[model samples]
Target: MLIFSVLAAAIAPGVALLAYFYWKDRYDTEPLSMVVKMFLTGVLIVLPIMIVQRGLMIWLGESPFAFSFIVSAGVEEFFKWFVLYHIIYNHTEFDEPYDGIVYATAVSLGFATLENVMYAFGEPATFGTLLVRALLPVSGHALFGVFMGYFMGRAKFQEGRKMRFFLWISFLFPFFWHGLYDFIMQSVPRSWIWLIVPFMFLLWYRGIRYVNRANSVSPFRLLKREEEVKS
Candidate 1:
């Protein structure tokens, strides 16, 4: 059926991207149960996020900048950060830098999944809409999660002022990146559409670097080497 097909297409990109981040942990993988739970939490989080955004828009009166940055980017990333901070930041299973990416990706995809479904419902359920959601919002959130998780991983192991610094960075950086992305998409003149592609390239370039950095310094690599030495 067309409806079912639309739903599947809506869900696929976020799921695929989540899987990519999960297995990228060359040192250690998080338990499937925890990842799934984190994801569900993300799906559930959509309600509160929307409620707060609606209230804020009512108070502030909506504009393109506010909608792009504050309502869309700020509120969404803040809630995602709040949950990640409370839930996974200090977990024992979060044993390495890359676990940051793994957990964050799970939550991000969960949020993306429901968001895509809603978009599909509103539109006429076309392949073009599916492709647009996949290319932009879903994948953009994954990259944003990577940016947040990388810092949170460091914050986990750090001490004193360093830890505080990293924690704020984790929360703030994603908002900055997401806000920029959303702003470009919403506020730019149609004649400037050409600029959007390069901006996306910038985000992806930074995302790839963060992925590499997280992998390179994974605490699990050190721990595994220690175990092998004792053997």
Candidate 2:
């Protein structure tokens, strides 16, 4: 029973984050099959990179700060973004700006799910620890994706000199955010722990606004455009 509870807490955040994206993307969402495939791609890509990073760090006698922030966060986020760009950048599914968020969120959640599983396995104090991890760290992954997707979509769809700038920002923003989040949580003293919660909440709040703005288009007009294209 105790173990089962642990697993539930571990799995719930990833599942809930994925569900939230699915719900938000109801109208212009990709098929479940594609979403799953993209997500799996993220997991497969990040896991290996993380493993090798840890190995190299151990060999070099490197500090966790260097490994976690510079190598792990930078490399992992880049690969995840690369996978999303490769798979869906030119696909028909990426019609709107918000589609970037949907796909990126899928990949991030995939990575988060596996990461959570590993953390949960090692964690001894089940309930309280699990709850805090789920709300903050796990959900932080989703918000990171939201930041990535927002800019990538803009870069792909928006047409202007500013679009390139936006694209650059989109790519770098998540990487910075992910790195900082990890760095702060890992390196900061326990006395400053209260700051982490609010910081993550700000990221979440920003993600929500991005999603709302992305989805602010008229469903009727989008349907009409589809019908016209079909005809």
Candidate 3:
């Protein structure tokens, strides 16, 4: 009973978050099946990579501090991006600019869910820890997903030099954000924890703006044009 409760508490928040984002981008939401598949892809890829990374860190006789940021932020972000590029980048569902953020969020949330479950099982079994992990760390994964999606969307839908630049910037944005967040929490004074709140707010704000901008066309107009062409 206790273990089941812990698993439920851990899994709920991340799944809920992924749902919220999927709902928000109603314009060009991919099929639920595809989202689930992409998410599973993230989990499968990360599991082994994390093991290898941990092994390499231990082999080098490095302190946890020596590699935590790089492993947590750099390596994780790279794998997420790689999975997005390889699996979903050229799919037919990636039709609109906003699709990028949606798919990215799906993958990130998948990784966060499994990680949260492990933490919930391993740590001191308590509601508070579950709450914090759900609210902060899990949400952090979604924010990183938003960052990756924005650029990937731009790269795919937008054209010319500016779009190309956005693509590159998008690729780096999640990595930098993930690294900075982990670094501050690990090394900074407790007083500085407040700083992450505003940063998180900024990420959410930017993510919403990016999606809205990408889908600026009126739905009715688009539908009419398609119908006219079909007729």
Candidate 4:
């Protein structure tokens, strides 16, 4: 019962967060099965990501920036972006901009959920600790997903130079932010821990914008509006 409770606590935030993004798709939503599959794929990739990060850590030594940027942010974001591009980018279900946010958040929260479970079990375990993880690390991944999905959505729906530009930023934008986020957490002293709150707020602000923007530009939104006018 105790173990079950801990597991639930750890997983709840990820589920709730995925639901939040999924909810934001007011017009057309991705199929539930595919979104869940993306989440599971995110969960499965964690092992390989850990293996790669471990090797990078061993090779790079203790340089905080290298580990945070190259190992943590680079490997993780690339894999997530790779998965998004190769598998879902061209899929028929990914018909609109908002679907990108929904799917990307699904993948990210999947990764965050499994990572959270491991962290919970590894540590001494407390409500406060779990709560902190929910607010920061887990939510951070979801926000990164928002950025990634937003750009990928743009890229999918665009053409020529604009499409290429969005594709590049789809990976780069999240890479930079995720790297910086990891760097701050790893380097900043506990005395300065209060700084993270403001940073998190910034992420939240930008993430919300991404969500709104994606939804606004969704082809389905215009289609829905046109249908309403015809009615």
Candidate 5:
């Protein structure tokens, strides 16, 4: 059916991206149930994010900067960070650095997937439209998750000033990145659409670097090496 095709097109990118991050956790994977729970929590927050953004738009006026930075990016990223901080940050399954990437990406992709489906159903979306959405918005969300998770991973095993710093960076870095991304997409002229591709690639490169960094310092990886040496 046409509807099924549309749904598949809309959901595939987010799911694929999530799977990629999940796979990147080469040591000490989180329980599947916890990741799914985080994802569903993300889906549930979309309505609340919309409600808050709507109120902010009315109050702040729909200027491009305010909408992009505050109403949209600020609200969405904050909610995502909140779910991570409150739920997964201190949980037992968050035992390794890479687990941060897995959980954060799960939540972000869930939010992105539902958003994609809504956008697709809102109008007659074409293959091109869905592809663009996948490459840009959905992937963008995943990248933001990468940034957040990378810092939170560091913060988890740190102490005192270091812990606080990484914790704030986890939220702030994603907020700024998300805001800048939205501003460019919403404010740029049609002729400047070409700018988006390069920016996206830059984000993707940085995200992968973060993933690598997180995995490199994983306690499980280090422990495995130590055991092999002892044997």
Candidate 6:
């Protein structure tokens, strides 16, 4: 019973967050098949990320700066971006700007779900730890997903050198945000934990704004005119 409870605690928030992002797809929805496929891919990618992080730590030794930036932010974001760009970006279902947010959130939450489970059950587990992970770290991944998807959305419809630039930005921007989140928490004294609040607020604000902008420019919005002409 306790084991099951711990697993549920790890999983619930990730599901909730995944649902919230999927809800934002008001214009048109990607096929559930692709979404699930992307999600599973996200979960599977966690293994490689762990391996790489461990190897780095072994090579460089376990230190605050490395975990905060390189292993935590750099490795995770790089793989997420790589898989997202390689797999989902070119799919026909990625037909609009908003799809970027939707699919990206799916992938991000998938990763978050497994990550939460590990942290939750890998240790003794406590209400405070679960709550903090739910509200902060899990949600942070979704927010980073918003930023990534926003840029990838822009990149998807881009051409020439513009696409290249936007794609790089899509990856790096989230890497920076993730790094900043970890850096603040790890580097600062525990007494200064309160400092994370303003940063979280800013992240939430930017994520919401990005979602709106992505939705507003959805290529699906233009489908009406294309359909009208076809008729």
Tens-place lDDT digits, model 3, residues 146-188: 8898788778766799777876776789988887777667776
Q: How far is 51's C-alpha from truth in model 1 (Å)?
A: 0.8
- Candidate 2 per-residue C-alpha lDDT over 1-231 given as tens digits, one digit per residue, 9 for 90 to 100: 878877777878887998797678645666788788877877787668787777767775666577656676777788777888789888887887778888898898888878887788975656788788788777888999999988887788667887878777877899888888877877776754788878887898899988887777524447867888999
Question: Sorted on lDDT, highest at the top, how do the candidates line up?
Answer: 4, 5, 6, 1, 2, 3
List pairs with backbone clashes in candidate 1: none
Sort by TM-score, best first.
4, 5, 1, 6, 3, 2
TM-scores of the models, in the given order? 0.94, 0.85, 0.86, 0.97, 0.96, 0.93
Query: Please, what is the whole-model Cα lDDT of each candidate in the order they appear?
Result: 0.87, 0.79, 0.79, 0.92, 0.91, 0.88
lDDT by residue for model 5 (87-126), tens: 9998988998888888889899999999999999999899
TM match of model 4 to true structure? 0.97
After superposition, the stretches of candidate 1 with alpha carbons farther than 4 Å from their true spots are: 222-231
Q: Which ten residues in a row have the lowest lDDT in candidate 5?
A: 185-194
Give the Å error, residue 16, model 1: 0.4
lDDT of 4 by residue, 1-231 (tens): 999999999999999999999988989977899999999989988999999999999999989899889999999999999999998999999998888888889989999999999999998889999999999999999999999999999999999999999999999999999999989888986844677888999999999999888888877787899999999
lDDT at 14, model 1: 86
What is the Cα-based lDDT of residue 196 in candidate 3?
Answer: 71
Q: Which is better, 5 or 6, measured by lDDT?
A: 5
N/CA/C clash count, model 1: 0
